[model samples]
Target: MEVKVKVWIEDDNRNLVFGSGKNEILKYVELTGSISKAATKAGMNYKKAWSHIQVLENYIEDKLVITKKGRGEDSGSKLTPKAKELIELYNQLDEDIKKYSQKRFEELFLKKDELISLKEDDAS
Candidate 1:
């Protein structure tokens, strides 16, 4: 068997502000410095990626990315300090949850051999 985990944050109004997909977009944008490039890397369209960022910003009531326009080479998106902090916190939370879930899953479900042996003993 396998285990999967997903984590996200919601605003006071219960609107989702951050999650795996958005996190990937944010990380990629930070790495590539361009929303368009990040969206391409993430297999999403520019519009969708921009929409996601906008939703997150609205939910959090903060601007997570600084956008620059024009055809200059320096034109690109950059993550705000708030965005960086949020990404770091979200990543840490994701790691902790994955570790906890894996440990619990092993304890509860990965002992099939032991369970089978116990069943055989009971049958005997």
Candidate 2:
């Protein structure tokens, strides 16, 4: 058997601010430095990607990316310091949840053999 987990953050208004999809988009944008490029890398439409960024910004009430306009490669986007911090915090939280879930799952679900043996001994 395998374990699966999903994580996200929501604002006080109950609006979703971050999740796996947004994280992928943000990471791709951070790596590519272009929303269009990030959208392509993530196999999403450019408009959809932009919408996702806008939603995140609206929910967080902060600018997560700085846009620059220029000709050719000069035009791209960069993650703000706050954006980087959010990404780091999200990643850390993801790791922590996975670790905790794995440990708990093992303790609760992986002892069937021991449980059966105990039952057998009790019967004997």
Candidate achieving the largest TM-score: 2
Error of 1 at 5 (Å): 1.4
Top model number, lDDT: 1
In candidate 1, position 121 carries an lDDT of 56
Lowest lDDT 10-residue stretch of candidate 2? 112-121
C-alpha lDDT of all candidate models, in order: 0.88, 0.85
* Models, CA RMSD each: 4.0, 4.7
Q: What is the lDDT of residue 36 in candidate 1?
A: 95
| Model 2, span 1-124: residue lDDT tens | 5467888888788778788778888899999999999999999999989998999888789999899988777678999998888889999999999889887776776776443333555777
Model 1: residues with Cα > 4 Å off, grouped in runs: 11-14, 112-124
lDDT, model 2: 0.85
List, in order, the clash count of every candidate structure: 0, 0
The residue-by-residue lDDT of candidate 1 on 1-124, one tens digit each, is 5469888888788877789889999999999999999999999999999999999888779999998998788788999998899899999999999999988877876675453333555777
Backbone clashes in model 2: 0
Candidate 1: residue pairs that collide: none
